[model samples]
Structure formats: C-alpha cells, structure tokens
Target: MTNSNHQWKKTALSVVLTASLLGTASMPSAMAASAAPEAAVTTDALKAASVGQASGTIAGTPLLQSYALTDKLQVEIKSLLNETTSEGTRIAAVVRVRSSDANVAKIPDLELRVKTADGYEYPMQASVFNAHAIRPGTTEELNFLVKVDRRSPSELTELVWYAVDWYSYPKKETVQLAVPVKGQEWTGPLSSFANSASSVLPWERSFTLSPALESPLVYTPVSVNRDNTPQGPVTTVKMRVENPSATKEAVPDFTIDGRSNGNGSTDKTVFPGKRVEASPLVLEPKEQRYIHFAIPTDKDTVLTNFNVLTPETFRQLDPKGQPSQVSYNVGRYQVALPVTSRTAEFNAAKPYEPGQPFVFDSLSDTIDPHLSVSMVEFHRHENEGEGYQTVIAKLLLTNNSDLPVPVPTFQTKLITAQGMTYSGNRQTGAIAEIMPQTSYAVSYAFNMPTENEDEQYVLKFTDAKTAAPASTTIGAYRVAMQETKLDVANMSFYPFKVKLNDWTLNARYNVPSALSPNTPISYTYRMKLDMDIARNEHVVVDPNSSKMQLELVDKTGRILSTKSLPFSGVNRLISGPQFIQFDTLRTEEHEYPLDINIYEVITTPTGEAKRLVGVLKQ
Candidate 1:
C-alpha cells in the first residue's frame, strides 16, 4: 500500500531533479570518455543521489551506509551478507530507519538490484521483509532477503536501491552504493540466512507465514502436499486463519496464483475450486479455522512462488452519519517456496521417549505458560492381506497456565529410517479445550504399507499457530511385542494386570445351493476370550475408553479379524465371552494365533496420557 502523501511525493521528486542537474554539471572527464553519453548521465545522477555511501569490500564486518529521504526520515544500511549457493546468490540486508520527532516513518516499498561489471542490473528474483514501519523518535531493524541468479560476489560492482513512490503515480527515486565484494566465497545452506527471530524471510525447512496482512485477520500456511495423478500434479495448500479481535470479521476472498519459474510464463490461477469452508464465511471474535485450497498444475510443474490477492470492500458511516462505500486494499502478498522438500533438519523439541513429557518452549512467548505434549502410546494394526497397516499415536497434552488453553490442530507425519514419509489422517481429541494444569489425550491415525511396519519410525508434530508454527519429534522405535501360550495368568501390561483365563474356538459350515448338505462351501470360525483386567492408579483412566483389542492372525502374521473391548471402569473382570468371527475360510485348517493388546489412561500434571502397555500374542 502507498504510505506517503502528495506533499512528501513532491519533496522527493524535487530532490532527485536537483541532484541530477548538479551531477551533470560536474561530470568527470575520464568517466565520460569511457562510457556512452546517455549511460554517463544516468550513472552520474545516481551517484549524486547516493548519500553516505560506504567504501571498501564486503569481507569482515559489513560496511554501513545511510540515506536521508526527507527531513523526517532516514534509512540506515546496518549490515549486508552475500551467500552463494548452487542455485543462486542470496543477499541479506539489515536495515533500520530513524524517524524525526514530528512524524512517524513507514518503510518505503524498497527494491534491491545487483549491478554487474558490464553495467547490467538484475532485479532480485524474490524478496521478503521483516517489518513494515518505524515509530517516531525511534529506530527499529527492518531486515530483508533478496535472491538473484547465480553470480560470484566479485562479479557484482555495486547495488542499486529504489524507493518506489506509489501515491498518485508510480515512480522510483534511485540511490547507488559502491559496495565492492572481495573475500573467500561464503557457501552454506540457504536456510542459514534465515533470521532466528523470524524464520519466514529467507525460507527455512518449516516457516511461519510472513505478517503481510493489513487487516485483523492473521493467516498462516500450515502445510503443502503434492499428489501426482493421470490428469496433472495437484498441490494442496492448507492454511489456518484466526481472528483475534473484538468484532467478527469476514474472511477475505483471496485467490492464489502460482508460477513455476521466475519468468512468469507459466503463471496460472492455481486454486480454481472454492475452499472447503462456505463462501463469505465470517469468523467470530477470537475464532480460528483451517482452510484448504486444491491447486491443479501442469504436468512436471514445481511451483516456486505463490501470489495471493485479497480485494475487500465494505460500507462505513461518514461524518454526516450517511453510509459510504469504501474499498480496503490488502494488496498482493508473495510467498517463495523452498528449493527442496525435506524433513525439518532441526526439531524444536527434543526426541522424547514413548512415555516421557516434551516441554515445548518455542511457543511460550506466543501462548502464556505453554503446554507440554508427550507420547502416551503407539499402536500398529496389520492387515497383511490388504497390504496396509493402521498406526495410531496417542498423545497427552497438559496446559500449565492458569487459564484454559485451546488445543491446536496438529499436522503429523510418520518417517521411517529409510526416508519414507506417511501423512497421518483422522485426528481425535483436538476439539475440546484443556483445563489449566490438566492433561488431555489425543490420537492421530496413519494408514501405511504393511511392509513398513518393521522399519524404525518417528512421529512428527506441527502446531497450527500462525504467528509461531513449531515442530517436534518423538521416537525411533521398533514395534515391541511378546508371544505367550493360551490361558496365561498374572501378566503385567503397564497400568493393567491381565489374566487370560480361557478361550474357545468353534467352526460353522456353510452349504452352497448347488452343493449337498455334507459338502461345505465355506466355514465361519469364532473365537471367544475370557479375561480379567485390574487397573492401577498410575495414570488417569477414562471409563468409556476403548482400552483393549483382540486380533486373530494367520501363520504369516496377517491379521484376519479383530475386535475392540471397551474398559468397564466399574469392574475389574471382563467375564462375558468376547468373540471374534472370521466369515471366509479358504482352507479346512481352523487354528490361528490370537493377539491381545492392552491400553491404559494415566493422569499426570500434564494432560491425560494414554499408553499401549504391551501386546500379548497367544
């Protein structure tokens, strides 16, 4: 948005015109002989406007330069670092502005251009800023990141700065700084250039959305996934929007456009289908919601940038108490996608054991007395014949603050040692709020290939806070199970003491219409289990929680059928026969191993944590 008024625009224009005329009169004889007449004039004009230009090369400490735009505003180039990578060169500039006592200073729409030795200037491919404005009588850092085509730092002679004037007409006042580049080439990972305070600028493995909104709505990009189909490559971008205001706000109607490359030839309106939420949705005060946008792109397309446009219009009362139409332009916001898609290189929380608590502090500043999360249990149900397994991760979250804390919807992934990643689906227990100093249990389920069950795996969690999205990891565990004979007694399963008293197996024959009564076409097998469970007080227990499961597995370890038994908090005995039936019998053999799994709900200072004590094979 344009920040300056007409008066400031006039003053900036006059300053540039005066400086050009003075520079032309004093043009040097050597520069004029070496360059064309037009080129010489333009170069001299830029040099004259360049105030407080820094000298020497960018080797040790970065050189600082200051530019005075008006009597009230001055911009300081505090530091600069050029990072070279195989794909491109990134320039990080730490900028600060000092405002006069009389007026507040808004950061000008700035552009940085790299000037080559041959006098060619290349505009930055992408850029991001840390802040938008500066307060009066105060100086604040407004750092930014700019990326350009691959070029040796020594090949660049100077940098050109443009302060765009967008009030009435579009124009730019230019300043040229002579920053020589000389030193060993600094080669490192691109994410290293990201500011620790705000990881959104340079782009990190996981980053929060940049604060580019002009309204009260805060939007955060949660995750992006690409799926290949016969039609094309479909990319789904999930975003979380929150309205932390006193008044309800209409969700902005934003359209996302994507470009495959910098040339913009492949630019397309990517998100054609409407969002999952209803159109013209209005968020209640302090309400948060998640929205998904499905973008179908051309085959073999990799979106490098996303342009979001939100055009909002509303009616307001004028001074005369009459309604007037007003246009609120939130303008366009750009997001630069990372060069590569990989798991997060760093974990915000440490790798915790299965039952240990993970105290996450990264969000402490955003949410007072941040909550802690712990892995209570991990369950893997194998359906070998179907070629897939259903894995569930149960977690306990405790709110340590005195006030109630709303549970954040988490995006989860299960990563194996061999680098295979599976996205989790069907999350439960995130709808309710966690009371202060109490724990709440939640579970995430993932359907993965049965072949991956033997591989070591880890669980990753990402919170959906727009301001500070954080990721944590737990595990590197192989499924632990034990085999036992039928009618085993006095078995320990963490918080539960179990005794399998007895079991019965029966088979029923089914006759086909064409076959005789003696000739059975199919067989139905049923197995009944009688067990006793004693619950301990080590963990908080829920009466209606499904705490145990029985699975009948074939000789090949494929589960043929399964049944779940809900824990009856009133009695320790599960006396009635619990039967599991398999309808189809391919062979005459009827014997199969039964696996019994027990679960426990425990209470701690944190939220309720549930545990899958252990699996019993009989």
Candidate 2:
C-alpha cells in the first residue's frame, strides 16, 4: 500500500474524534502542564531563545509557514508574544492549520508550551481553536495563552506547538516558531447539541437525555409568610430527554415525584408549588423532548429536592400464569439542573393577532434548535357556485439547525365574525426532505362561511409538538374577480386544456337541510382538462405557485360566498392524461346563474410564467 494510504488509515481515529468533538478536542497532559513558572527573563533575554523549524514537508501537507506535524496536517504560526505581569510572564501564540486531503478537518485539541533548558515546561493556560468543521483544502485558526516566570525566558531553549491529526496519530509535539504576544477569543458558531445518555443507561433502551444527568439537589433562597406558607421567589431548571433506543423500548416518560413530608400536619405539602409535566410521554426512538420545572422557595425555608422518576409499563405473565400488568421506574435518577438563583424569568407573548401572518412562536422540538413555522399570504376566494367560499394560506417552514428533520404539519382553523368556526382541507406538498438552512412552502385551504366576505376572520396554526397556545389573525379582505369568456370549453391553456364533454350539473348531496337556506341546493362544475398538452413531458407543480378561486351567487346575481384553493395538492409530477376538477359549490336555489373562472399557471421554455384565464357562464 502507498505510504499516504497507510497514514490515512492510521489517522482515522483522530478524524472521528475531531468530528465527534466538533473540532474541540482536548489534551489532558497539555492542560495539566500549564502551571506557575519557576523563573523569569526580560524580553531581550527571550529574544535569544532557540527557534526550531520543520526540515521538510511531513505528511503530504507542506510546512508552508511554520510547524509540520503529520503527513496531512501542518500548523502555521500567525504570531507569538511574551509580556511581564505582576504575578508572572504571559506567553501567547496565534496559529492556523492547513490540511492536504479533502476530508473535513477540525482542530479540536491544540496545545502550546515553552520548555526551558533547565527541564521546566510552561504550558498554555488557555487555547481556543476554531472547532468548526473545515472543508478539506481550507485552514482553521487557534489562539493560545500561557504564563511563565520572567526568568524562565532567559533559559528557554524550545517553544512547542502540540498537535494531533484526525487519525489520532500523535504528531510532532514540539516545533519552534517566532513568539509575539497577542490575545484572541474563540468566536465560532456553537456546536450542535448531541446527547450521549444512552451510554450510561441502566438497561438497554433506545433513547437518552441531552444533560446525561442532573445536578445533585441544591439549596435555593425562598420567601415565607408569618404563617409559614411559601410565598414568592422561585427557581427553575430545564432538561431534555432523547429516545434513540430500540423501537420497542422507545415509549418512555420522565417524571419527578412530589412526596409529602408526612409529618402529621394539616398542611399536606408535597414540595409546595412543584409543577409536573403532563404526558403519555412516549417518544419515537430517535426523538428528543424537553421539560422544565419551577419550585417556589423562601430564604427562610428550604424546599425538598423532588425525586425524578421514569416509569415503564409492560404486560407479562404473572406467577399465577395469567397475563398481568407491571410498572417500574428506570432508576433512582435526580434532577440534573440546579435552581440556585432566587428567581427565574418568565416572558409571556401574545398568542393570536389578526391581519398578520400566523406564527407558532415556539421551538417544535425541545432538543432541536431548528425547525419552525410561519403562515403567510392568507386571503379569501369565492367559488363559482352559490353559497361557498374557502380561505387560502401559505405555510413557510424553515430549518436553521444542522439536523435534517422532517417538516412538521400544523392543525389550523378559521373563526368567522359571527363566532362560528370551520376546518381547512389537507393540501400536502411533494416535499420529501427538509435540509438544513432551507425553507419549504406548504399550502392550506380552509372552508369558510358564505357570509364572511368583507368581515374579519381569525386564522390559527397549532403545533402538536408545543404546549404554547398562540394564533394569528387575518383581517377582512376584499375578494377580487378576474374573468374572460372562452370561445369554446375545449380551449387550450398552455400546459392543459378544458374538456367540455364532461360538463354536468349535480345536486349538492353533502349539504345538510339546516345549512340550506332554500330547497333543491345544487352544484355545477365540469371535468376541466386537455390531455394533449404534454404526452411525454412531465408537469411539475410547486405547492406555493398554483391556486383555484371560486365565488357563488343567487339567481339575482347577489354574491353569497367567495373562496380560494391553492394548487398545493396537485400531483408533483404529471405525465400522460390528467383530469382537473373545478370548484364544487352548494346553493339553496338550483336554477341560480353560475360564473366560473379557472386560473391555470404554466411555465414556458424560458421559465416565464403564463396565466391561462378561462371563464364559464351557465
């Protein structure tokens, strides 16, 4: 095998560790060596210190500017310095890295120290490196701070920058570079959260918690009244539990018990003001959930630390040979977070507002920092038939976290001015994957009351993942009309055409008598489509782009209701012959005149959008 290939294999351990640590690897020996220096030396005296340089490229990567560590890794010293302080002399170094291969790289652990001729080593006090994953062929920087005795510089014979590569191969630990004093702060995006709780599980299970364990119960200050009742002051702690165990073991719950002191007192207090989480509390094997609790306290009284509990139930054979139920706690777990502070902040936000986009203003997943939702482009549309209308909305979902989670769907409702409510239809998009840092547009269609035009309505979005209650309001909007009389029902609309042969008038079978203001309510519509548009080409419809509008009226042409339906439910890919169903409307009078307008969108060869307007009168 080639030497390069061998080196790559040898370095695999370091590489995996770097990735796991998110580029913030640490070295115990290096950290322990950073202690008080024994001697001191002036700046001029350190100027004569010995400087070492790499003889040649080490690991395929060239020693372009400074130290060479391995075949694929090299460090370029940016600056170094030594300054005298009241307690001792401080040494600092600024360095960056260069890698030869295309693999992602990170400098999780880098340490620097000065070794005097007298066998004393002054280790770096703090080292901050850009721990972010670096694309191969790119460089990452790190800053180091060290303190030593002023006299140590005079006897300093070597300054070393320690490094280990991705493969866990210990590279050259000592290399010489010019030292100049400078300070740097580590400023990089925080690493994504990863829970390793499964490793410490008492029994085999699929999930873990972000904070593997809780802190030992601690004391916090609280207030008490003259009657000894706990008053103001409260402490809170947050925790996340993740399920990554086998599928069968995925159902789990987290709980904290509030047992009373049983002191035979009239006040049967069970950790007064202790709040418990509500749950069936089962999670998918790979799901992570969060919870928090607050305890009221007073400086004069100490609240008891509640016992954390997680129960699992099973159906099994009993000693009597009959199937029986059994429940048990996972372990004697304690709360991991502390309520050391006297009080916690609780910020309350409004839940609903009209005339604005509907936003569920809470994180969907307790453990994930990404995946949120917003609803926009809310409007009203009138159907072509009498007494029917629908509200159309666009859902703009976004993901800013590194985890590529499935997009979530929200339950929605439309509240009319008369206090009546209606439900929306499910118009799913063709989205399969929600990549990080990307957004998807989802469409929603809500059936509305016919008398709601020119009157305000409330649109609300509810996320099943969150308990926060919030809603968005949409104001009264004017329903506009666009019409064009077609010469024939068989006319073509760029990508599609309407078929006049399938036209028919049918009774509104689903309308209840109470909802029908007149007798013989009926619906008029046609099977609208032309199959010859694309025999081989595929029709791709974006959920956010296409729409269907409808308006219903009485015999005298009095407008009843208006509604709109976005083409969000259209098949993502269409080929061969496809049929289109026009809006279905319900009216009390069967002989009312109908005005139908079909708006179809087609993309031209150059990507220009063309709208096909077809109007039908019966």
Candidate 3:
C-alpha cells in the first residue's frame, strides 16, 4: 500500500503532502496509536508533529499531542471484535510494550484505551516492554510487537482511536496501525415491533442450468411505519447461480422485515446449507430471459435486500409449527442501501487549486451516476515569482447532465505591485452546458517577473448551485512577500453560538509548498482575548469584514470558523500550512463562553478580522 500508514490518515489535513493512494487496498493499516507508558499524559495537548510533521488530533477532541516513539520501546494498539455470544465487550484492543527507552531498564506498566466513534473511552491492559540501558542518541531496536483484539462481524465505520502520551523518553514517536474490522449490525428485539413474520421456500432441487425463468417464494410483513402502514417491503431480487446446469441444487427461501428499532426495514432468510433441495427454472430451449417484479418503495429505500427464510423442520427441530426455543433467536437481515444526507465539509473545500481535482466524497450525493468531467483546466497559476509574467487558465467540458447546476469559471487580469490592472482576461469569464451542480476545474502554469512577490486576480461565479447566476470575486495569490506580522484578538463561530470551549481553534492559512514562491517568508502571529469568564457570559463576535472585523459572513450573518477561509485563493494566495493558526489554548477546567475578535494585517490594501476563542491554563 502506498500511503497505508496510520499516521498519514490522521494527519493529512494538516500535513503538507497530499495522500497519493487512489485505491482502497493501498491505504493506511493503522488500527490506532500505541498505549501510553505507565506515566504518560493522555490529554489533548501533545505536539502536532514529530519527525517530518504530522497531525496531533482533531480540534475540540480530548487528544493533545504527538507520541514520542523512542528508538527501543515498541507499543502498538488494535481494535478487535469479540468472537463469541457470551456477553462481554466484543470489540476490544490489545497492547504489547517492551523496553526500547534506555531510561527504563525493565518493563514498565502500560495503560491502553480503545476510543469508539461516539467518543466513548474504554481502557485495556496488557504486557510490558523489557529492555536495557542505551547510549545517548542510540537507536536500540526492540524485537516483537503486535495487538490481539478479537474480531466481530458487526461494525459501520472503522474503530477510530488515539492513545494518551507516554512519559518514556529516549524512545519517542508512537506507531499507529489500523486493522480492517467488518461485522453485522446491532439488530435489537423485534417482538414488540414485528407485525407478522414467516419464511418462504426453504428448499428446492435444481434441474437445469442456463435457462432462468421464475422461482416461487414468499415474503412476510414485519413492522408498521409511523402511519401504521406495513413496514416490511416487497422487492424483486436478481440472483446469480453458481451451477446453472446442476443435476440437483438446494435453493433456500427468503424474507423481508424491518430494523430492530422499527426505523427502517430489514430482510433475512434462513439457510439450510447444502442440505436443502431445489429445482432450477427451465426456460424454452435457447430462450433465456429476465423477469421483473413491482417492489414498492413506499417504506423502503432499497428494493433488493430481501433475505431467504427457512422453517424449524429444516433443522430437524420439532415439526410443530411452534417456533424453536433457541434456534431462531436472532433477527434476520439482508443487504440494502440506506438513505443518507449528501455532505462535504465546506471548510475542507473552499481553498482549492484549480488543477488539483476536487475532493468531493460524492458517494451520498444523488449526482447523475453517469455524469463525469471531460476536461478540467486552469489556464495559469495566479501567482508567479518576482521576475517574469505568468498565467493560469482552465477549460471544463462534459457531456453528462443527470445532475445539473451552473459551474463557476475563472478569468484572470494581472495587477502589479503598484496596484494597476493591465489588459487581460484576468478577472472573470463564463461557459455554457457546464450545467447546474455540475462543477469542475482546470489549471495552467504561469511565469511571473522575478521581483514581484505575487499577482492578483478576481474570480466570478454563481455562489450556490442556484438557478440565478450571481457575480462574485474570488482572490488568488502568488505570495512571495517581504516579512509581515499578523495579529488578531477576537474570534468566534456565530449563529451556532460557539461555546468558549469550542472557538479557540486556529487554522493554518498557507502551508509552504514547492508550488509556491521558492523563498522563505517571515511571519508573526499574535492575538488578544475578550475572554471574561467572570463577566462576559455570552461568547459572540463580528462575522463580516466591516469597520470592526474581516471575512464573509454566513447566511445568518455569523462568521464561519477561520478554517473555512479560501487559503488557496489565487489573489490571496498563501504558501504556509494552507491553513493559518493564530493562538489557540485549552484550559481543562474552564467553561469560558467564547466571544473574541481577531484581526489580520494580511495586506496593505486588503486584510481580514475574525472572532475566535482562546484558553490558556493558569
């Protein structure tokens, strides 16, 4: 796998390099961070990066800093699923610690935790690390290391985890490993919700192979919707037979039911293994055809999740129609696609380079499943170095339109340090057919004069994928400027009423990259806190770049987080960490309501001011 390391996944948003792994199998293998040493801190204040630089943890979360995985100490954590029916924590993790830190001559006590998606914390214990003394800066290699977590068959998102800091020094930097966990979903008791249930066609003998026609089956209704409608759904399911021309085959029956909580419906069928007998449909000679059924979608989002149902007699249980006491205790389920919201975090989207493909996770969007970008171009990169003149251009052309929406196109006009707009297609441009919601980008390289630190350009586009096209200007920068100091006092996330505890976060405005001016730029960051825990009970700040602050306001006029700025704006191009951080602090025992204003000396003519939160320990 190209970028399969656990560290890469956790730190991608902050790290300068983009993850190159395009395929799934070639991704991170980190289960979670290793356990903390007997006396390490497990709070959310560790260093963000260690070796080449990495992300510490998500903002607002309990995790603090980097894990100092020294040369000799070996520690690894893995979330495992419990393998049996016995009631115990089925999903767990294992830890192996050994002496690599020369400071510890013997194995030290270890503390471990398996943090779940909902932010639940579970701690575990395991072996210790055993090693000897080490020379200064010596890399003592430890031997064996592994985590033994039981595997379960039910899990949605992977088990996301990070461990507290380990006090062990000399051996720094903890390793992370992510193990692929797959399991069945949690289906609760159905006795209360199930309206009616039954299993159809449990067994049949197959007689033919290729000619598939119709097979008799049955479906039992399970629950009722809020309107008291039959919750169980009816749908046709196509199947692929392994042995189409078999002399004899066992075909099982299936059923459709609702989810345990009666939210959505589910389908499950009993399987009698290879013992059931069934006959394949025999079609007219040389006449193979497909059949369709009217599966209603009134209460079901997916029409293909029906499961096979079986009777107790198939298991040699009492032939009586009475349900078996223990054999059929579990709820039945089938494969169905559930409806979910379409989302892509705007904070992660706004600042983008034209040439680089947009990172929209469209899996949930109802985009035309077949629409695709034919050409995405950026005529020239907005910012070029000091000496020569450069250009950035692009062309977006596609033929699919199941999903339609107006697309934004950029036009460039070059301006000099003296603030002069010369003749050029620099400001804004337009195109047709690039229908609504069907947006993409393109880019081109440009060379600029050697003395110029940056070039400026404005972009025009319809703000939302709305029908009416609106004109708006977006800035692009070719930053290679002289030293500048940046300061701000108040910061806030409005409309949503940012709690003092949640608004102190900072964002890296520009991450230094090879694509930027090949020169080191000096920058200073400062801030003032309007934090008055004893007095100011409400945390609020100005959201717009007006007489008091900077940046655009949300629809509700509240300012979005600093992380939402367009760090990649061509006219306002920054080459730092892509995102910029003012000062952000976290005091463990403070309930300071967030309310502060932040200002930036971004440029002489143009700049920004914001409101955010800050908390420093006394």
Candidate 4:
C-alpha cells in the first residue's frame, strides 16, 4: 500500500508537470464520469441530492459573484436553493476548505455558511481540517446529507455569497464568493418551454424525510383528514408550520402533505402501513397555519415537494422535514408511508401449524434494518444415553450509514429453564460498527438437554435501531429427538415387598439373574431386556448395534455381557399433521443393579459443553 501511494504521488506530480494534460475545463467532466447520472430536475433549482460541498473559509473573496449576461433570459427565474433535506436522504456532499497561505505549522479555524436567495445563509457541519495555505484552492465534498422537503426551488435569486473566517490562516482574515447566473424559466407549461429551449421550468426540486419514517400509517380503515393513529414500532417526526400569507381570513383554508417520490408525485405520504394526522390549519385574517402532524415513513420516502396551488387546498408545505410536513387542503393527498398493504410473515418452520413464528411486524409490516439472519437448524442425537438438542443462528454486519453508527451484538434472553437464562457468554460478546447503510452478519449458538422435554429459545436485536414494543421476538426451538428408534422406560420395582412377582428371562446358552424359576442355575437375579420402539418400521432385529444389552454374574461377581431382544409394541414415530412425539428412554437390566454412567453433550456455535441430565442410580 505504501508503494502504491508513492506511485500515485508520482502520477499526480507528472500530471501537474504536464500542465496542459488535464485541462481546467475537464474537472467537471471527470467528476461526472465518476458519479452516477444526475437526478432529473423539474425546477430551475440546483439538484438537491446529497452531494459533498467544498470546505474551508473563503477569506475576503465574496462567496457570490454576478455578471450581467449580454443575452437576457427570455424569462428569468430566481431560486433560493438550500442543501437541507428530509430523512433517508442522508448521503452528504462533504465540502472542506484550506487557505492558499497554508503553513504546515498552523491549523486554521474554519467555519461554513450557506447563502439562500432569501438572503439567508446558515452554517453547516464543522470543516476542521487545517493546512498552511490560506488561499489554496479550498476543496471539500460536503456531506450535507438531507432529503428534499419541498419542490418550489429556492433558485439563485439575485446574488449568492458566504462569509468565512480564516481562523489560523490570518487570525481574523475572511473571504467570500458571489457568482452570477441567469436562471430562466417558462411562464406557461413545458409545452411552451419545449418550443423555447431557452426556457426551463420555473422550479425543479425533490426532498425526503429525516431519520426516515418506515411503514407509516396515513389513516384508519375509514377516516377524514388522514386521521390515522400511530401503532406498532415507529419513529417520530416534528413539523414546523408557517402561513406565509397576508389574509388570515382565507375562507376554508385547506392544505395536505404528499410523497413526491412514489406514485409519480400524486401519492400522499400517508398510505397503508403508516400513521398520519392533520395539523390545526386556519387563516384568521392574515394568520399563517404551521400545523404539526407526525407521519410514519415506509423505507426512506420522498416528502412534500408539491406546490400550494390555492389556499382552498394548500397554503404551505415542507415534506423534507421529519414526517415530511405538508401544507395543503389538496384533495386525494398522500402523506403517509406507502408500504405494502399486505403483511409479511416469516415462519421459521412450516405447514403453518399451531407453533409460533418469528414475527417481523403485525398487520403493518416492520421495516427491517440490513440484517442477514441465517436460518436456525436443529439436531437431535441418541444411542449411548438420552440425546441432546441444539440450535444455531448467524448474521453478518454491514456499514449502512453515511457516518459510523455503533452496533452492538446484544444477547436476547432465550428461555433456559423454567426461569433460568444464559444471559450469553458475556466475556466473548460480539461487537462491530456499521457504516452508512452497510450490512453485517453475526452468529450465536445455544443448546440444552432433551429427553422429550419441551424447550424454547429467543433472540432480540436491541441496538440503537431495530427497537419495538416487544423489544424482542421468539428465537426458539423445542428439544425433541426425531427419527428415534427405541425408547425404553422402566416401571417402579415391586413396591409391596422387597422382591416379588413373576420376573423371568431366557438365556441361549448361559446363566442368568435369580434361578428362582430354575431347578439348577448358575446365577441368581435375572436380567430382562425390554425395548420401546418409536418408528415401527425402523425397528429391526439383527446383530446390528440397534439392539439392547444385558449382563449377570454369580455371588463370585464375574462380569458378563449378554444379548437382549426387543419386548413391547413397535412404538411408532406416530406421524401427525405436525410431528409431536413425547416418549422416554431407559435400560431393562436387573443384574445386581449395574451402575450406569451417562454423559450428555450438546452443540452450540462456540462449541460443545457438558449438560447435566440428572442421575438415575444410587
């Protein structure tokens, strides 16, 4: 990498030396070639996409420059453009600046100010990088990321300028720029402008909402003024209302908000799967109506870029703010989230039986963050002893932010026991950061002992984002050994006496336990081998390991391993509409009560661990 940097330096130097190689006029072309196609413009206003701005303070130089074109515009259009935005349009065009008198020793204090055709200019994010040059061609890619809220272009009216302080470059030195541009627009329709290529639309603009509202509700099944109540998980939007009109007595004042992004600009921001409300809009004589209503968003949606055609329908609107505030009595208006009217469900397993399913959202679907959750696979093992059940899940993390957003792999409580919880392996906690809309996947594993015991699990994503009323969801699996063969169970010993009842066993060519039924026997107590078959067809009689074991000896204590046969019903796996089998396992040997030691192990992503399954012997 170091060597590559050296090569790049050499190339840059050679280009500088070539002087005429890359012409000054080619800069714009180069930038265009690197970026995607520019957004379509309908207004004479500048494109409002999140683009980086040039940084640093322009000292003494006027930020706005004007020139009287010898060629007058057939129809002049003045727009007061602002780079502010609504939610979801967070991609910023960062702009940085350094003075021409950059001294390696001193760092300058840089401040940025944006000018509007309204003669208003505001400061942006801090442009802090410092260099020696005070007037060096200051450059920055401004990340003034914001979605457009309104459409009426803030066209470059008369002059555009900014004031900057050359902090360290020269203590109190400052600069500005004032460029002149003859923006033209058509007085009539595009057809008229089409005939006159010299004329453009009086306005061309777009906007989005902040923090982006997802799956917003516009109204109930039936309601007026989009009086939809907010339900389920959602973000909040604060709108500022202003009635910039003279006569507050605008009889029957009406205004509405619209989502300029979807449905070709006619759709309201309030749609299914979202919530909406009407602001108290009234024009008393000359009073302005700045009604604040919160509208939920579906994904990152474009906001109110619609114009207030008339006070009967609209007096003002701003769709780029949170909730993408809109002002219009515009009939058939849309200002709620335009999400899928139908709900989406993710059932972990199917047949859609009685069991639970991991719910993303209710009637209204939940907007999911970029999370890559892999399917959870389950397994059951048995042979030597009662088996173990295991469940595994994983996800990867991606940086999905214009800026770094801290992401933590949190532990959602999974039902461990009746009331026990594994909190998680705190020491080995997972952690990472997701940058501007990135994606990531991480894995967590869990396991437990299962001898037909029903178990449940859970996983929750409680980070800065991905919050909900439940604040969690079901990430569970019931422990059961499927496709099981033999399941033996033992009945209690004869409780009436120390030893009684008819208990017997036949040996092929050896001794047995208790010769009580034998005239002359080699051993006393007999060992009976009883097996409970689960899958009737899966149970087979052969020398295969599928059989049970038994042993017996005389008082001298001679260890003996004996063969045993199946005894009992062919316990079928009992296939049902949904597999729900509950059975037990046990050995059928009474040969002096041999000590049986069983060790159960379950698997998890981290690894396997010993699971205490309780002792069965004295």
Candidate whose lDDT is highest:
1
Model 3 C-alpha lDDT per residue in residues 390-495, reported as the tens digit of each score: 3433333332555554433333333444443332332222333345334433322334444544423332121111111111112233322222222222322211
Q: Pick the candidate with the highest TM-score.
A: 1
In terms of TM-score, which candidate is stronger, 2 or 3? 2
Model 3's TM-score against the true structure: 0.17
Candidate 1 weakest ten by summed lDDT? 56-65
- Write model 1 residue lDDT over 1-618, tens digit each, in one string: 244344434334433333354442222233334334454456755665443222311111121233454556665544344556667765544445667756666665567665656666666422222456667788766544456776664344554556556563556554422233222112222212122222222222222122222246766665565655455666656666778689998875665555465233454433332354457888899887666566677766777655444433334455897755433222133456556534342222245555666544232232334677667556664433555666766667777888878876655677664556776663433245777877666666667776664434556554333311222221233322232223346654334567877777676666667546567466677767677767654233354343555545666766555544455445433645566666654455555454544444322222233334446566
Segments in model 4 whose C-alpha atoms lie over 4 Å from true places: 1-98, 102-154, 158-177, 180-232, 235-618
Ranking by TM-score: 1, 2, 4, 3
Total backbone collisions for each predicted model: 10, 57, 142, 145
- lDDT by residue (332-374, candidate 4, tens digit) is 1122332321111112312211223333322211223433233
Better by TM-score, candidate 3 or 1? 1
Q: CA lDDT of each candidate? A: 0.50, 0.41, 0.28, 0.28
Candidate 4 displacement at residue 290 in angstroms: 37
Q: Provide the TM-score for each candidate, comma-separated.
A: 0.42, 0.27, 0.17, 0.23
* Candidate 2 least-lDDT 10 residues: 184-193
- Model 2: residues with Cα > 4 Å off, grouped in runs: 1-363, 366-372, 382-389, 398-405, 413-425, 434-439, 448-460, 465-545, 548-618
Q: Which one wins by lDDT: 1 or 3?
A: 1
Residue range 1-618, candidate 2, lDDT tens digits: 475455433334333333233222222232213311211222233333212111221111111133344556665544344444456655554556668767886544546676655676777644322344567887666555555656433334455655535465554353323221111111111101122221222211122221212211111211111111134444343344455454523323445433333443345333423223565455565555544445444433443334344333334445887756433332222222223332111111133342233333332333234655555345554443545665565556666677676756555555553445555554555665577776665556666556666444455443323322221221122222223355444543322343443333333443538766665535544333322222112223354355433344455666544445443355432333434443444444454466554444322222212233455566
Residue 545 of model 1: what lDDT? 40
lDDT for model 4 comes to: 0.28
Over the full model, what C-alpha lDDT does candidate 3 score relative to the true structure?
0.28
Between prediction 1 and prediction 4, which has the larger lDDT? 1
